[model samples]
Target: MKDLYHPAEPSLFTGRESANRAYLHENIRTVDLRSESTPPTGKVPALFGYACDEGVRRNLGRPGAAEGPRAFRRGLGKLPWLQEAPDGLADAGDIRLDTDRLESAQQAFSEGIAQLLRSGYFPIGIGGGHDIAFAHYKGVRTYLPTGRKLGIVNFDAHFDLRSPGDAPHSGSPFFQIARTCEQEGFGFHYACIGVRRDANPQVLWDRAKELSVLTVAREELLGSALQASLKKLKTFLKRVDAVYLTIDLDGFSSAYAPGVSAASPMGYSPWEMMPLLDAVLGCGKLVSMDLAELNPAFDTDGQTAALAGSLVHRVLHYPGLF
Candidate 1:
């Protein structure tokens, strides 16, 4: 773990100074996960960075997401801390991918997440690729009590259940989680929102059906239909003891989130999705969360990163979670 981890870069957390206000950059503390120092005993939101996008490269998507964490921090840092939060925030640093060994890197990251959970900290993972979902689930499973059911709620344009033919990639994280659950004698409860009909194919849809995956299509959330969709989402939430929420930037319309591994011309807006997000977070079942695929290279004036940062901010401000 020490070899794979590095201290959080201090320079990324900088913003305008204010005498009576608190900004994220001003309050977030950088922790050296590799150090011998003891972990926090109180519940706090800890940010973990996965600095690899080999999965995106292998999945044949435009790859620049490896640098997502830095961009996300830059955008998040400037926002003032509005609500009452824990003493401050903690950054456990990044799991650097020095080689092409995505699997090994993910394993190390999962271990780190498990450590955070054991220390009573809520993990907020910033992604290198959508593939981090597998690692995130593994960590949560490791920390959760035995026999407790885990629910996965994903906001994505694609189902992400593609078969891992040669190896796993950004397109196969959920499928990987399903396989892992099956092998371990646990049920896979996954509910995917914002699925674009054109983004996925018949075979993937068939695979989702085979796995008994619950899906709410992009169109289902349009206009008045969102109420029905929310009810369906609430029903799904009742079936699990815990929830792991993941947001893929591409799930939003390209106009709102232009920097992602796969940008969709038509997708849901933040305004349309916040209600759903609030429902999930307020339900008191959310255990961990992540924001994935923010590619700064393609971002227009840092719009996508700011959006991702705002989501993170929302999580931090949610009173129920803290």
Candidate 2:
């Protein structure tokens, strides 16, 4: 109900139209002060941007992910939709954080996300950093009925299980989340894919064991080994009721997604994970979803942004809409 977001800049594509009549630039119903306050029909999934990277800064990573929200929008807006984007598509502008109030900003994000859900819209968060995943989860946790299982599936390179110190940083969200789950007397069933063994220290791995977190390593997402992991993922998926799926762009190989807070040499191509995404959506348990860590500053040819956009397009059209 509050004006939690700054109206997103509508500066988008100026491309030639195709006969297919399927370009996002011509369609996405972007929310401004005037639009989001109105009740959503929920026929279309609500799209929004999280424009802050203070978490990345606190975690001592690169600084440009603050620009991630708009950059991703630019990439998403220009993609040829192949089919008309559904009429219900709503862009709820962006929640921008420009001050030192990261905690309060996260609260605002949580509230905004919750509002979307209550208004009958499925929320799609294009993020500023991976720490925003906590806020995303907060919204889902708040809106769902009590005692429902909340499963978090992160497509990332690190476990993100670092303990929060005097302040919470990007690396500390999952720790905070797991702790919250414990305090709330719920299962902390977190499954992480593409975790690079070398990227995390022994202590983090120990922490994972302590939390009983399910994981698949970077090596496992590759060639022949991936099949077994996919089966494992199926087993993993069967155990959780609803899911909050988050994608940290750094989860993809630097070749496929170089513009992230942390680039990875061993990351898998985004296409390789398509089946997993399909399976996750097919389970019909996906609640809130997010894409994080797209750093336009490091993006070489806009390829990462394009991939992020493509992934979103696929998500919006799941079950073969497009």
Q: Best lDDT goes to which candidate?
A: 1
Question: Candidate 2 lDDT (Cα, whole model)?
Answer: 0.81
Global lDDT scores for all candidate models: 0.89, 0.81
lDDT of 1 by residue, 27-71 (tens): 888777665556665678889998889999999999899999989
What TM-score would you give candidate 2 relative to the actual structure? 0.93
Best by TM-score: 1
TM-score, predicted candidate 1 vs. hidden true structure: 0.97
RMSD of each: 1.2, 2.2
Clashes of each: 0, 0
Poorly placed runs, candidate 2 (over 4 Å): 1-4, 18-20, 32-38, 320-322
Worst 10 contiguous positions by lDDT, candidate 1: 33-42
Clashing pairs in 1: none
